[model samples]
Structure formats: C-alpha cells, structure tokens
Target chain A: MNKSERLFQLVLLLRSRRTAITAEAIAEAMGVSVRTVYRDVQALVLSGVPVEGEPGVGYMIRPANHLPPLVFTPDELQALLVGNRMVQAFTDQDLAKGARSAELKIRSILTEHLKQHAEQQPYRIPILESDDGLREVHGKLRRACEQRHKVRAIYLDEKQEKSERTIWPLGMIGWTGKWTLLAWCELRHAYRNFRFDRFEALDLLEENFRTTSDISIAHYLQSVIGMRDPG
Target chain B: MNKSERLFQLVLLLRSRRTAITAEAIAEAMGVSVRTVYRDVQALVLSGVPVEGEPGVGYMIRPANHLPPLVFTPDELQALLVGNRMVQAFTDQDLAKGARSAELKIRSILTEHLKQHAEQQPYRIPILESDDGLREVHGKLRRACEQRHKVRAIYLDEKQEKSERTIWPLGMIGWTGKWTLLAWCELRHAYRNFRFDRFEALDLLEENFRTTSDISIAHYLQSVIGMRDPG
Candidate 1:
C-alpha cells in the first residue's frame, strides 16, 4: 500500500474503535515493521492529523467537530429511493411529506451523477385510491404514539357492536388494506389492537401516559408473534 | 486541514469525478501551490496508488476493484429500519420475508455499535390480520413485474362485470391499505391500473413482454399524477 493510502486507512481504523490502538496492532494492520510504524506515525503527526500516542499505552484519534461528507454506493441510494417511495405511498400525508422532504434534502447533498441516478430511479409510487378515508385518523394516532398520549374513541367491533374506550396509543400497524392501532385499552386493563378505520369518533386526549417496559411496541409485537389475528 | 488529511481529501476529490482533474484545479481545491500538488501527486504514485497523469493535461485514478466499507450515520440507519418495517407490515409474505432477510444481512455487516442501534430500533410492524387473502396473487404479480412477463387474468370491475385481460405487468404499487398493479393492457392498447384484490383468477403467461419508454412506470405515473382513483 502507498503511504498516502496507508495514512488514510490508519485514520479509518482508529475512527472505528473507541479505545486506543496499540502500536503493535497498527504495525500489523499496516503490514509494516514496528520501526516503519513509528516513522509513519511521526510523519502523520508532523502533517497535523490529531493522533495522540502515549509511550506505552497506545494511539487514538480525538473526535473531530466536522465529519467528512457522506458517500453512498449506487445500491444504497436505490434502497433509500425505494424505501421512501413505499413510505410516501402507504402512510398518511404527514409521514409521506416527511419522506419527500428527506429525499429532497438527501439529494441536495449528493453528487451530480448520483442526483441524476436518483431521478432516473425505475420504481414509482402511484396513489390508486382518491381517498382511504383514514389519513386524518392515522395522523392523529401517529402523533399520539409519538407523544405518549392517551386517546378517547368510539370504536366498532367485528360484530358491529359500538363502545366508548380510552386507550394509550402505542403504535400504528398497517396490514393488507387495513390500519390497526395497537394500544393499551384502559377499559380492558390490558393491551389491545383496534381497527383504525372502525372509529366512529376519535379524539386525542390531553393526558399523557407513562410507558412501562411491558407496554411498548416491541412488547406488543412479541406478544402477538404466534397469534392469529391479534387485532 | 493537515497534509495527511489534505492528501486523503485529494483522493476523494479525484474519485468523485470521471474526468481527469487538472493540477491547477487540484491546487485550487487543496489551497496549495501547483508545485506542491505536483510533489503530492508524485508521492501518491510512488506509494503505489494508480494515479495516471499527463504533463499540462490532467490526472485521474483508475477504478479500484475493492472499495472502502460503507458507513452510515445513525439517522440513515434509522430511516432504513423504519422503511423496512413498513414494507414488512404492508406487503405480501414473500416481500415481508425479504425485508426481514435484508435487515438481518445489513445488521451482520454493521459495526457493533451500529448493530446494537439497529436492534434497538423502536419502530415495529405487527401483523394485525392473519391473512389479507392476496399474498399469493401479490407474489405472482411481483414476479411477473420483475421478469417483464405478460399476465392473463379474469378480473372483476366495480359493477361486477367479469372479463379476461392480457397485461404486461410494469410495477406493483402499494397505496394506503391497498395494492394496485400498474400494467399495459393489451386489450385496450393503453396503460391501465388494476386493483390487485379485484382479480377473480390470475395466471402468468410464458411469453415475455418488451417495455417501451412510453409504457413504463414513469409514463404511467405521469399519466395519473392528477387523476383521481386511477385504479
């Protein structure tokens, strides 16, 4: 390896770990003699890279305030594009707008070639339905989830039975052609999943709820993993 | 920046562009004298990095077979996790499985800290319904889209009128709580969108279809951007 390349790689290796790397380790990584490692490190220090070396301890790089520009491979860019397209198509307007904004910001920082690559992306998202009649409710529930707030609603069951319920909104789950709001039902004194579209009246309550380890989305998903129709 | 950092930055600048960078341009970017740039370029070549140079012309690095490891910030990782979660929740079983496999593979290559961050991803996708009753059809159409194959389907319209149609499956779109297949209908000799769930019977034809620029997902999306209920 060339000295310039080795120097670049040395910075990367140091940046990868929090602990100081030993000189022996550096020598091994650089495929050089111990004496050469010493000389190269001296050269690096003279050039003004902030590498700290202690006599018998080791070497470490102090964290820099500014980071280098982030670069992504073509495949990574493709993944980001496709993922954002899915989010824009499958979620409410708020989240969809966030997705679009994020895409725009990411593109702004990309190189010209990558910017064109992103524009020529083959995947496209088309809104097939004019209205799903649940964007407002989805947004409200999403906010409730984000804020750890309670919600009050009049919901319908599978049997078409209507009832008023107060719940702690945990997370929103999208099944095929359906939105299910996973929450902790205060009435049931246990976790429950309610069909989002089945709400007759919905209101975001002012009261915030404290989440225990047992009441998170992860816990709820774990509880329902092997069950049939958790909702 | 120190000389080592400047040298590293020089390599990055060269890599970002396809055209050879002039010494004057390199000096401008590095805030150094043209003589210093020349000395540095000579040092880089001597150190064995493949930088090709021509006097009074420009310099460029040949494409390297091996690339540095891809690194992502915490926000990028979070975006990936959330996007994969949405895909897992809303798509067919095959796609859901693909999302899971992707998450696993990504985590495997990530740094230990990043792997931990990925595992602690708060977003969750819980399947509320045991069956959407369309996973099989979704998989079929997705494969058809991937292979550029024609599909023969007995479809039901809004009025319950049943008819057979031959379509070149261009792409699959997931709207809120619905999946729509965008295709070119051979019967109509025009682009069309079909409700994925509206298929009474579906079959993938052995024949592959050629996609023209005018009949692509981009064209279909452009044609329906302002239309309501395109499906």
Candidate 2:
C-alpha cells in the first residue's frame, strides 16, 4: 500500500485495541521495517494527531480522539448491506424508510471504490408469505398504538362469533403462525390480547387513549407471554 | 483542552466529513495555529496513518484506515444508557437480556474514567407495567419465527369461541397497548393476524418453515394493507 494507506491502517490498528501499540508491533502487522513505522509515526504526530507514548514504550490513541474516517472491509460492507436489507424487509413502513435512509448515509461516507462495490452488489433478504390485508391492519394498529389512539375492531372468536371492541394498543406479538395485539380493552376494562386476523374490520378511533408510561411495547409483550403481572 | 484532546477533536471533525481537509481549515475550526495543525498532521503521518496530501494540498483520511476505538462521550453514553433502559423495559425477556448484554459490551470498551462515571451514574429508565404470561411465550414465538417453525395456537375470537389452528409465524408488530402476531394460517391457507391475549394455548411444531425468497414481511404488509396481492 501507499504511505497514506499505511498510515490509515496504523491509526485503525491503534484504535482497535485498548492497550498501547508498539512501533515494532505496527511494523510486524504491516510487514514493513521499523524505520518506516517510525517515519509514519512522526508524520502522524507532526500532523497534530494525538498519539501518546514514545517509540519504545508503545503508541496509544487516546479515547477522546475523534474517529478517523471509517473504512469497511468487503465482508463488513456486505454484512451492513445485508443487515439493512433485512431490516427493510421486516420493519413497518416508516421503519423500512429509516433503514433505507441509514443505508444512504453510509453510502455517502464510503470511498469511491467501496461505494462502487456496494452499488454493484446490492444485498437483499427475503421475507415469508402471509395475508396482505392482515399486514396492512397490523401496520395501522402499530401506528395507532404508538400514537396512543383508540382502535375499534370487529373481532371473530373461535366460535366464529363477531363483536366490536375499543382498545388501547400497547404492542404486538406473534406465535404459532398467528398475530396478536396486546392492549387495554376499554370494553374489558383490563389488558387483553386480540388476534389480528380474527378482526372482521378495524377502525382507528378519533379518541386518543392513554399510553403506558414506564415499559415499552417489547417489555410489555415479554410480560404477557411470560404470564407475569406488571405490578 | 490538552494536545491529545485537541487532536482527538480534529480527527472527529475530519471524519464527520468524507472530503479533503486542509491544515488551514483544521486550524480555523479548532481555533489553533496552522503551525499546530501542521505538527499534528506530521505526527499522524509519522505514526503510519494514511492521511492523503501534503502541507499545501488538502488532507483526507483514506477509507482503508481502521476506525478509532468505540469511544462514547459522556453525553453519548448517557443517551445510550437511557435508550437501552427503555428497550429493556418493553422488550421480551430474551431481547431484554440482549439489551443488557449490549450495554455490558459497551461498558467493556470504555476508558477507566468513562467506566467509573458510567458505574456511578447508574442510568436507569423505569418501565410502567408488564403483561402476564407473555414474555415466555413471546420469547418462544420470536424463536419460532426466527427458526421458521410451524406453530399452533388455541385461539378465541370475538364470540368467546375457541379453536385451534396451525400457522407459520411471520413477524410481530407492536401497537400502543397490545402486541399482534402475523402469520400464514394453514387452515385458511392465507395470511392472518392474531392477538396474543386470545391465545388459550400455543404450541411450536417441530417442522421449520422457510422465509419467502423475494417478498419481505414489510413489503407484503404494505401491499396487503393497500389492498394489493403480494404475488
């Protein structure tokens, strides 16, 4: 690699570990002579970079130092790209958008070569099949729950009987190829879980509901699934 | 700030922007002498870092460079602590544990001073309530969904009728007060959403399902919600 490239690698090596890095160690890692390592160290220090310690004692990058430019190896880049794609695959609409936005931000930070590779190899993960209608209702319910709005749904039970109820949505849970809504049912006057598919119709009520203060939807779901009382 | 601190700040400034940075620009930004910027650049380059360009030409840290340590400022740490706590509050048991694990990992990477401060501060965000019998089930369901296992749930509809159905769990969506499950029902041979509370019983079958090859759960939900067929 070129001098600049070697210098960049040195900075990365210093940042990766918690302890001080000796110039000899740097030379060994980079397959360069100790003299070259020494020269590079001098260049970094002269450039107003905050590297601590002497040549013999070992070089340390202080924690307070701002991160140098990020450089991802090919594997790392692929991992990120694939992970972002997975997030987009499973998340709600807004969340999917956020994932795309994050990918763009990363792209903006990448070097030309890395950016080119990223464009050439677009990573995408697939999702499972399910009812489109249920997914839509689920999305709406999630938003309503976040907003603490009341939701009205015509729900069907095991007996194939249907009824309407107003609920304060807290979160959602899935099990056994089924989806459930965890909420405080105004009609039931207690916390309840409603099946999403069983709902004949769903309506977002104009009236807003009180949201839970302490726990998040995930935590609440945990408690319900575990059969534990929040109190 | 000390010289080391100053250098750290300079690196952060340059890393924040992916373009070329000049010594004069660094000096003006940090309100330091250009001579000092020159010294810092020399130091960085001498340390075998990959900073491109010379005194007159602008400098840029190459992308091949390694990232500095994962150091978090006090404010940033506080934000993470708070956010993690919030995640812990609402996530299912497994996820809560995962959150704690991540926090511990973060702590391990911090400097002694930051670690001490983190311990002393003991940042905690409270959660309001927990659901009964949901956490464990949620954990199982999440695993099933991840493993692509078939699930069977004893479900109750609006008429207080109960029935059992086999499903392929797709994903979970959380609303304000409740949790919902999305899946493909074997009985209906279509996608369905179910409520966690309505499940009288849930079972995870030994058979594992495969996620669809192209469509993600989010895309399916969007299309379905928009009254479009996923196929």
Candidate 3:
C-alpha cells in the first residue's frame, strides 16, 4: 500500500470509532510492533491529523471534521459519482449540466495515479426524463412560493376543455416524471393541485398570500393523502 | 490515531495503489522510522492483513473491498443525505417514505455523537404529493417495460378526447415532478411520450416485442429531447 492510501484509511477508522483503542491492540491488529505503533501515532499528530492518545494507553480521532475538502476515500468518491449520475439522468438540462461539471471537479483532485479507479464507475444511473423547460417552470414556482404570490393560469383539462382561474400558490411537487403545483383555488373555494404540463400560460399576481385562511403545505401533509388530481 | 485505525489506513493505501511503495517512503509519509514501518509490516502480515513486501524493497495491499461497510468519511454521509433528501422531498409518497426510513436506518449505524449531526439536517425536503397510487402505477409500467410487453391504455388527450390505444412500452422516465412512458403507438405509427396521470386505465398485453426500427431511449437522448406528451 502507498503511504497516502494508508493515511486515508487511518482517517476513516478513527472517524468511525466512538472510543479510543489501545496501542497494543492496534499493534496486534496492524501486525506491527509496539514501538512502530507509537512512532506512527506521533507522525500523525505532528502532521495535523488530530490523533489523540498517550504512549501506554490508547488513541482516538477528534470529533470535529478538520480535514480539507479534497481528502476523500475511494468509497466516498464512488458514492458522489453515483449520486451525481442519478441527478444528471433524472433532472432537467440545467441541473444535469451542473452535475456533469461537479463530476469533473471531483475527478480532478484524485492524485494522478488514483484517478482511474475513481473515474471508472462500477454502476450507472439510467437516463430518464430530459425536459428542457422543466427547470424554468420550477424556478418560477419557487419564486411564487417564496413571495407568497397569487397566480393566474389558462389550464387544459383531460377532455381538452379550457378554463382560466386564479390560484394562491403554495408548493410545487416534482414526481419522477411529472410536476404538480399545490394551491388554493379562488374559484373552487378549496385546495387544488395543478399539473405543470396542463398550464398553457401562467402570470404571477402582484398580491401576497394570507397563510392563516387556506391549507398550508404543512397542514396538507398532516391531513391525509390527497394526491387525486382534481382535473 | 489508534493502531487499528492506522492499520486500516495502511490497507486502504495498499489496495488503491497500482505499484508497491518503499518502506522509507511509507515511514516518511506516516511520520515514523524505517524500523517502525518494518515492524508494522510484520504485524500486519501475522494478523492476515495481506500486506506484501520484501526485506530491502516495498509493500502493497491486495486488491479487495475487504474493508468493513461502516467505514465512511463525513463528506460521504453528506452526499448520501443530499441525494436521499432530494428523492424524498420531490418524488411521490412511496419513494419519499422509503427515503425517510432509509435515513433512519443509516442514522442507526452511526456512533451516538455522529447521530446528532446526521439527524438535524442542515436542509429539509418538504412533502409535496401525498398520493398512495403513484407508486402502484410506477410499478406496473416498470414491469411492462422490463418484461417488454405491449400495453393498452384508455388515454386522455390534451383536448379532453378519450381514445383507447395499444402501445409497445419502451421505458419509463421519472422527472422531478412528472412520470412519462416512452412507447411506440400503433395508431400513430410513431414514438410517443405518455404521462402517467393521463392513463384512465392500463392493461399489459401477453405479447413480447422484437426491436427493429425505432428511435431508442439512448438514441433519443443523443438526437433530441423528445419528451413532449403527444396528447
């Protein structure tokens, strides 16, 4: 094993442990002598690894995360890669682009020789939806929710019937392949769920909402599973 | 650090390296003497750590995922949290519920101190759709795609017109807020993207498909973003 890899493994073991482990036990575990263990421990401490212990007793890692961002283990790299790949495949173009860039940055840090193992992923997240405008709509809804603005939209029903209505926007829900906007309908005098695809056009109103009157996202969560699309 | 942790680090370094590292190099990197490195190498050998070396040469760890599953750095945990939270907050009830449970399980394995930091996440995934049926539809379509079965559905058009059509199911794409089925429509004689909510009823046919001439998911991804619902 290379010195760098051994140091990384040391960080992992120390970080995972809750209590200190004895030098004799550590020596036995590593298949080394007591003197060797003591010297290694001193080396780690001098190099700012925060390894704490005495010569006779034992050693343990500090509770705080003092390591730099680039100090990652092989498994950590795998986890990050799988996650970024999943995001790239499932989300809109903008988010996918972001994930791709992040993957490149992560790859750049893996000490030149260790790069290959980290780059060649053992698993892959399959590509799914690739909508161009989904993230744009997401941004708008997010703004509306944060500003508590009322919104008016021309909506199309399953029968292709058209209806124009003003709604008090609450939250946006993203399904695996679909998106829905939760709101209180001024026309129906009740809570309504609007699908993003059904909206032909939308305009954010200048007015803010009064949360005390209608159902909030939190309240809606506590009530029941009301996911039936009221088309 | 404890001897066990150091030993583990040594193993990690060796496993990731393509070439052997010299004892002097190991000693300098670990901040220890050459004699200490030699003794540690012997200890690791006796304890069945698979540390390979020679009298005047270097050492390396065998290629293996032999490290315990619990070995995780703080950043890896953070990556897992962000991914799972995105799935929980954005997807439907079933996936969200699954994510919530998984977070709890991952937390259970952590040391008590680590548990506190993991539980009160810096960010939150808000509940969106509370539908109990979204998961069921996802399952059926998944089954159809995997089995390569032809599926018939009572589809609702954007114009609200109802039409019964048979389709060769290709793949299901799960967007953050949508669920779409990519298939070849018999009536249209072309590729079509069908939204899950538009399916009034679905029936999987007892027929398997033979791929010949059509734009596949990979091809579509490469050529164009054909996610438009041809309602």
Regions of candidate 1 where Cα sits further than 4 Å from its true position? A1-70, A73-75, A109-117, A120-123, A127-133, A223-231, B1-81, B88-122, B127-166, B187-231
Q: State in Å the error of residue A4, model 1.
A: 24
Winning model by TM-score: 1
Q: In candidate 3, how many Å is residue A153 off? A: 26
Candidates' C-alpha lDDT: 0.69, 0.61, 0.60
Real contacts retained, model 1: 0.19
Say which candidate scores most in lDDT. 1
> DockQ ranking from best to worst?
1, 3, 2
lDDT of each residue in A1-231, candidate 1, tens digit only = 567656755665666555677889889756798888887777767665678989878998776621232244444555556666776565566666766665665565455666776665434566435544576777778778877879999999999999999999887765656668888999998888888778988889889998887887767666655443211
| Model 2 Cα lDDT, one tens digit per residue, B88-188 | 55445655665566566556555576676555332223443455366666666767776678998899988999889998888765543345677888899
Error of 1 at B32 (Å): 34
What 10-residue stretch in candidate 3 chain B is worst by lDDT? Answer: B67-76
Model 1 misses residue A216 by how many Å? Answer: 3.7
RMSD (CA, Å), each prediction: 11.7, 16.6, 14.5
Q: Across residues B1-231, which tens digit of lDDT does each residue of candidate 3 receive?
A: 445445555555565455677998777655678887787777677655677877566797665444432223333444455555565543334444555554555454455544664543322344445544655666577667656788888999888889999988776655445668888788898888888778888999998775563445554544566443210
Could you give the CAPRI-style class of model 2? incorrect
Please report, as a value between 0 and 1, the fraction of native contacts recovered by candidate 2.
0.02
Error of 3 at A46 (Å): 18
